[model samples]
Target: MKAFLDILKPNQLIYPNTVGYDWNQVDVNRPQGHPYYHWLQTNQGEGVVNIDNKSIILSKNDGILITPFTPHKYQSDQFWTTNFITICGYASIFFQKQLGEKKYFVLRESSCVDKDIYNLTNKLDSSCDDAQISLQTYKIFLDILHGVQQVSAEGYKSIPICWEIKNYIDDNYMEKISIKKIGRLFNISPQYIIKVFKQAFNISPYRYLTKKRISEAEKLLISNKDLLISEVANLVGFDGASHFIDVFKRVENCTPLEFRLIYYQGADFNHE
Candidate 1:
């Protein structure tokens, strides 16, 4: 793996520090961690992040913000690649307040802001003085924070019915559900439900349900390592482990066990 890092001296607006990447197949670990905030954005393949003993899976266009002195480690697959920036200052204080107490945030679909971050980092790299670098880096940090906030706000502004339907599916993914059932609950025809849902979410109701179930199953598999495959299948509304494995493989390009093993390699397991 290869990385390009740049560190700058501290200033009033921000303390700009390293911005770089682990090109591929890199084991990036910080047992003691850094004193400044770190924002890591993945551009390709998958990476596993362990922060304060919590594990997270990051894929393309996903980013994570980690706070100061948090024990964290990350590793990428053969094709995994990322760009990241580390910084702190008064702006960081505001960012932290906006961030709340959470040590990390997983940002999805951040490609739109990636270019700006890259450009800002390049500008910082070319900056001739401490004051210029600090100001530019502070702007980059603010942009990142604002971009995440905008994405979050947009997520809540989807059509009411579509949001309600998605919430319903998420809440009851363990049960068998159909378009007709959803339509009946919402007092709409199944055809209308399908049409508006597709328009709103870009996928059919069934696909959304499957994705919700699979996503929940992934969380369960990661957090509760002792759960049997069949148990996970049942929990996620699949009839059996075989069907669950098939769907998981189709969507993730890896079986449930394979996915689990890749992320939780040394964890103990209870087989069934």
Candidate 2:
């Protein structure tokens, strides 16, 4: 059985929908994602949480904060207990922006999570009015955010290489890019780029760029009906139409035209 604290709307900038403690968390799966931010921590045993394409393991004291609308699911690898809180409002948007490009964080510090915090908050909830509830909630939120920022700062040097490479790719994927160019910028070798990029993100830099290009191509095909396949390919950084078609087919299991025909025209996509 699981025990949780629920507070009705507190008429404040930051309020929690629910807070749970020491709960034997059942498997949770939400594909479209929860509407409010979910900040969770492991209290006992081990578990795994998958966010989008990446999976993270939660050991004792480890925590993860999932922002709104992030596809996620979690299950116990063995026995697991956790504490969690969900918060949202205008203030939540401010915090989310503060978190930067990523919508989720696999927090590795105790400061971001406290033990049996729901019990204390539950008592506060019973006695407090809307104003007090709001204040307390905002305080906890602020503390966690501040703690996460500190943890991130301390871990910055250890992380930047992978995130830097990914950020550069994200911003410049539409241009002519090469591993050598990226290596030169980072003062690292092309081989290191291939290996570290793969280790961190589980995909080669070249394939990552290709996938990014193809993703944009899909959007263009759906939205702009006038553009030819060749135009779409060039716009997304592919050199030639044939090459784009070949890569798209290999990756998406359909030609760009077929995808456009199916998704845009509202038909099933198996090319006749």
For candidate 1, the per-residue lDDT at 237 reads 98
Residue-wise C-alpha lDDT for candidate 1, range 223-258, written one tens digit per residue: 677999999999999989999999987765567886
Q: Against the correct fold, how does model 1 do in TM-score?
A: 0.51
How high a TM-score does candidate 2 get? 0.53
| Model 1, CA-based lDDT | 0.71
**Winning model by lDDT:** 2
lDDT of 2 at 141: 68
Ten contiguous residues minimizing lDDT sum, candidate 2: 263-272
Give the whole-model CA lDDT for all candidates, comma-separated: 0.71, 0.72
Clashes of 2: 0
